[model samples]
Target chain A: MSDREVGGAAEAAAAVIPGSRAMLAVIARSLSPLHGQVTVPQFRILVILADSNVALRSGDLAKALDVHPSTLVRMADRLVARGLIRRSENSASRRETLIELEPAGLDVVRTVTRRRQRDLRRILERMTSGERAAFVDAMQSFTRAAAADADADLTSFGL
Target chain B: MSDREVGGAAEAAAAVIPGSRAMLAVIARSLSPLHGQVTVPQFRILVILADSNVALRSGDLAKALDVHPSTLVRMADRLVARGLIRRSENSASRRETLIELEPAGLDVVRTVTRRRQRDLRRILERMTSGERAAFVDAMQSFTRAAAADADADLTSFGL
Candidate 1:
């Protein structure tokens, strides 16, 4: 890209930051109820389990989180202590254990999700119908491009 | 709010998450070049100084970052060691020291910001003109509501 073109792009991109931070702030606030009970990484574990209803192999969970297997075990120990997750020997493999989200884990995830939705609703309902329609359209298009870029590999171009 | 109303809002709110994550991912990738060289919190210090232009009092910087004064001192000491920032005693006040972003610090922030903007432009340009217009409008409206919600204090209603 030409320097001028990159400059123009930079201007357009800067527009998104402040607003994005605000939305992220909103999402974070939704997690406040968990406070000291569940740290962000711990909540991430709950989310992964909540997303996949079936129990995850301990090895697989560590890979998904990009953490060392030992690190995953340490984190899981805390969650188990808090009754947020349970571990069971994998029936398919005697050597493997599966991590399953406990009912309490799911409940906390749902609570956080519901709070997020409420904040979204409160903010979204304030916009005009035209704006909302545009929001949906804009988001669809943006997501499509974002996905393609992600697939292209983000490490390119010194990023 | 009625259950139906909240449910509707939730549906609308859900549309933003995937795209928001995509955008946030892009922003994060822009920071990859700083990996091991400068941590996220350290970059944050650079950004605040870049934004302010002038040097900031050490105590003020600590308060702005919501970190303990001693913690800020340690972080600043590291930055001073790296030559990304410098600390100097306040001439006006015998008690205070000032933290200033060095030219190197400004350069890094610019590089990351420019990378982010380029990604933004690339994504935004792929959209139709109508979609772009809508995106801008949607963001403006959304940001306004976000500001109001922040002012309302997110802790209310269990966040």
Candidate 2:
């Protein structure tokens, strides 16, 4: 397609599809309380840790976040200083340290998550049950497609 | 509700709703090309400028982005240094400057937008037409609600 056609198509798609920009705006607002307390990446780490049933090794957590080990370590240091996360020597391996969320970190995650859900629930309440069901279905399909694409890309890179 | 109950409700909502985290992960993957070139916030500026028909004054742009004037100024400086955006004297006012996308900036916006659409379309193709319609309807509702919330917050804060 010509550049103009491409631009038009993109605009049209943006109008119909759930633009990430809008989703992000809502999310940012929901997480406003955590603004100065932790950066988004650090908050993400807290969420991951809070959700895990067992402590994760620093390297494993870094891999899960797709961040460099050094970068993860720095973030972990900050979280530790803030008393949001704790790092302990892995009993299974003396050379490795495991990371887990502190009670404060878990509280932060729960607070932000509850606020986010309340915001979403308010939005959802405005829609019909049918609309909600369809949205859930569509989202599941989209999420699967996106995941497949990511897997393909990873495979291509021999990951 | 108890904390556990609240956590359970949030998890249930996350399962049914189009969670912003998933939406963001998809968007980040789609925009991976812009990585190391420009930050996400800078790219957002490019998008806003590209979408607008006329140049936007710094104050207006900052308001549109819900960011501080100083922060916007710093971001504008970085974009200017990168040659992706140009700050020109607003003909209407000598004291204020207007921001517009340069050709390079427009190109970047188009490229990223096209990829984003392609990714979304690939996902959409897997859905039924009814599902697509419902998704659109639900998204429109959610976006409007989110915008209203933001507006109410701004008004409350006298912004």
Judged by DockQ, which candidate is best? 1
- In the range A50-102, model 1's lDDT, one tens digit per residue, is 87789999888787666799999999999999999999998789999999999
Q: Flag regions of model 1 displaced more than 4 Å.
A: A1-11, A150-159, B1-10, B148-159
Candidate 1 per-residue C-alpha lDDT over B22-55 given as tens digits, one digit per residue, 9 for 90 to 100: 6556766677788778987788788878877899
What is the alpha-carbon lDDT for the whole of candidate 2?
Answer: 0.69
Give the TM-score (0 to 1) of chain B in model 1. 0.84
* Residue runs of model 2 more than 4 Å from their true location after superposition: A1-15, A18-21, A140-159, B1-19, B128-130, B144-159
Tens digits of per-residue lDDT for model 2 on A63-115? 87788999999999999999999999877899999998889988898888677
**lDDT (C-alpha) at residue A107 in model 1:** 90
Which residue pairs come into collision in candidate 2?
A: none
- The number of the candidate with the highest TM-score is 1
How close is every model to the real structure, measured as TM-score? 0.80, 0.79
lDDT by residue for model 2 (B59-114), tens: 98788777999999999999999999998997677999999988998888778767
- The window of 10 residues in a row where model 1 chain B has the poorest summed lDDT is B150-159
How big is the positional error of residue B10 in model 2, measured in Å on the Cα after superposition?
9.2
